[model samples]
Target chain A: MSTSRSSASSKSGARQSKVTVNSQWKAYLQHHRVTAKDSLIRLLKSPGSSIMTWLVLGIALSLPMTLFVSLENVKQLSRVWDQSSQISVYLKKGVVPRLAQGLSDEIQALPQVTSAYYISPELALKEFSAATGLSDVVEGLESNPLPGVISVVPSLASQDAKAMEKLQDQLMHFVQVESVQLDLLWVKRLYQFMELGQRMVWALALLLGLAVLLIIGNTIRLSIENRRDEILVVKLVGGTDAFVRRPFLYTGIWFGLGGGLIAWFLLSLGLYWLSGPVEQLIGLYGSEFVLSGLGVKDSLLLICDGVVLGWLGAWLAVSRHLARINP
Target chain B: MAHVRFDNVSKSYPGGHHALSGVNFEINQGEIAFLTGHSGAGKSTLLKLIMLMEKATQGQVLVDGVNLSRLGNSQIPYHRRRVGVVFQNHQLLFDRSVFENVALPLRISGYSSRDLERRVRAALDKVGLLKKEKQSPIELSGGEQQRIGIARAVVNKPSLILADEPTGNLDPTLSAEIMRLFEQFNDVGVSVLIASHDLPLIDRLDHRVIGLKDGRLLNERPAGGL
Candidate 1:
């Protein structure tokens, strides 16, 4: 009986503390909601300065985001061209068309080669005449000077310079082949250039990210100075450091969120403005490539970046300055 | 038990300026006392020690059986909540209304909305400014502003109230009225300490007096025997 009574009372005590914890949690959330709303309202009250800060943050956020997205698109375009790394095998002038077709069949069966198509001397002459508009001059020759060619396209996995060189050496050993041609230097150089561009973009992003941090930090510091009296009074009245910091942290979030949205809008506007001209330029090159803007995933990431930077900047400013403003 | 206790407490500034040295006093729970000293005589520093606003260079200060020196930074806010404070200059935020000013302490303490509203109104009513709740404190007279400050201090219903020259600018009549207000709170079992230089006014109160001069304790007088 005694053991049961003690257990019952201890359970009751546990429940009592649980109720208090629940209420305290509720109160904590309530304060956060109030502080967040109050900070947003304060920002809205001062429209001119708030808008300027948002604009400045937006421009800063957009510079790197713009470069990143543009590089992504350019990388996609180069990837398409890179996959087309092909080798043209020219047969001797006197080689028979049947032997050339046999050679093309054998090349197509190679592991690295994707597809091989044989172009007869007759078809080659016709294509050259059509391309250069030199049919009568080419027909004026005693016989067709153009050689039979086999164009070998490598698989996507084997598009690198070393793999192309290996394939070229194999093709040169073909009995009917005269010369093997592969433009290897430009392909290697383009790969290196694209990698450098990507690294440069990332470096720029880091520098600009630091700039954003300093901007937000300075802005919050000025705000802390402006409200020096309020902070002192709050501290005097028993406000905790966390309580005093809630509103400023919320303010930083607002700036970050607003700035992120503006950057997204600017990127979309810029992409839209450039898309038409970009399409026309690509069309002139007889290729159809569309310029893409920030997708949903990237846009969300940009906004999250702004918010994180804003939070970190505010935290830095608050921790450094609030300590000095003792009651 | 004493609501506030200082045992050989000493405080010194960075440049070796001792704000308080070898100060000792105890205000038992439910007692009202006045701390009298000239300007720069360590009255403020003694009160600051109680509030944990300034740490003592040596010795201990206790409030409600808890050593203040042992309290960490995070515990200071809870300690201040238990001890209400009224400043000399009526540290009221001019941008807010009278109601909001009194509600500041309760809000800081995270009172529910219903409790906050009812308690704020009660505090304002106690100070006789219930009807002026919506008006900005800047629009009120000096005495009214000070009353608002007092209302704010007591809004959270702290066990102890510390006033630093709360009536420094008020005339004799207003000052006596403020003393009566503190007495009323004392009558309800709240320990009160007022730091002031108004000797005549302090004499009229007939409360216990703890005197200090040049960072040293002078003497103590029992109530009704000053």
Candidate 2:
């Protein structure tokens, strides 16, 4: 009975302390909320300085984002051309129609070659005469001079430059083939242009990311100087470094968030402004395509990037500057 | 048991300047004492040791039977919360009202909103500035600002109060009133230590006094004027 009573009292004591600690955490969170709000209000009290910071950050963030969007649009346009890769195989002179048809069958049998069509010399000459309207000149000739042709389409997977070049070389070595023309140089050029654009965008993003860090770091340093006296008083009153750092960090977050919103607004406005002209151009070409702006995912990513960079800059400043202050 | 005990305590600054050496004294619980000395006589350093502001270089400082030397950086704030401190400059934030200034310590100590209001009001009442809660400290007189600093120090119900020249800027009449307030707290079982060079004023009060000169302790008085 004595042990039971002691254990019961000890349990109650433990519970009481637990309750106190929980309340302490709650109170800390409450203070954090207040500090966040107060810091934002402090920023708002000086609107001119704060707006300049946001505008600088917004311009930095929007440049790379605009490049990325344009790169996406170009890629969308090139996708249609990727699907229509064709190769023209011209027959050697003195090749018979049956030999040409047989060679076309052999070309189509290759795994990388999707399909091949045979064009006899008779039909080729007749079509040429009709197209050129030169039947009198053709009738004056004694023998037909047109070569048999095989039109080949490569598989989607083998539509790259290296693969097409290799296939063309192999066809040139064929006994019945005289020349092979793979018109994929335009596709190759477009791909190179897209690659260069992507690399440039990444470089700009990195350079501008550093710019953002410097901006936030400088702002926080000034803020620390402005509140030097207040910081000393807080420290003298038993406030820990973490406690004193809470408000400045919140200020940095607000700045980053505001910059992100500005960038998003500017991006959407630019896209809206361009959409009308782009739609008319698309209609002039009788295209059914629509201009797609940044989706929900990209916008969220942009904002998250701003927030992280802002946080990192503020953390760097606080850790460096706050420790130097002594009460 | 003594509320504060210094056992051969010594302090030296970074440049080998000896601030205090071989200082020894003890103030029992519920006692009021004055630390008097000339400028740069280690009076401030001695009080700072008790508050754990400056670590002792040679010996131990025991406050409420806890060795101050054992405290780490994380523990310093908690240690300070138990000891109230009033400054001569009354470093109150001008942006806040008088009530907010006094309520700061309590808020930092994690008091709930409901308890915070009552405790802040009670502290203001004790300082006899209950009517000026909403007024800014800038509008108040010098003595009132000093009292607001005192209220902020004591709002957490600390068992020890350390005042470093708390009334240095106030007149003799106001200084006496501040001393009476410290005495009231001492009567209620709080140890109060005041460091000041105001010999004429401190000598008029009936309390134990410790004197220091050039980093050495002179002697300790039991219960009398210096």
Which candidate achieves the best DockQ against the true structure?
A: 2
lDDT of 2 by residue, B5-93 (tens): 99998899899999999888887766678898898999888877877778999988998789999989888878887788999899898
What does TM-score give for chain A of every model? 0.77, 0.80
Model 2 misplacement above 4 A: A1-19, A88-181, A282-286
Fraction of native contacts (fnat) of each candidate: 0.25, 0.20
User: Candidate 1 on A110-206: residue-level lDDT in tens?
Assistant: 9998999999989999999999999899889998888899998998878867777888898888778899998788987877787888898899889
Q: What C-alpha lDDT, on a 0 to 100 scale, does residue B147 get in candidate 2?
A: 97
Model 1, range B107-195, lDDT digits (tens) per residue? 77777777678989988999899999999999998899999999998887777899999999999898888888887776666678999
Question: What is the Å distance of residue B68 in model 2 from its true position?
Answer: 3.4
lDDT agreement with native, every candidate: 0.86, 0.84
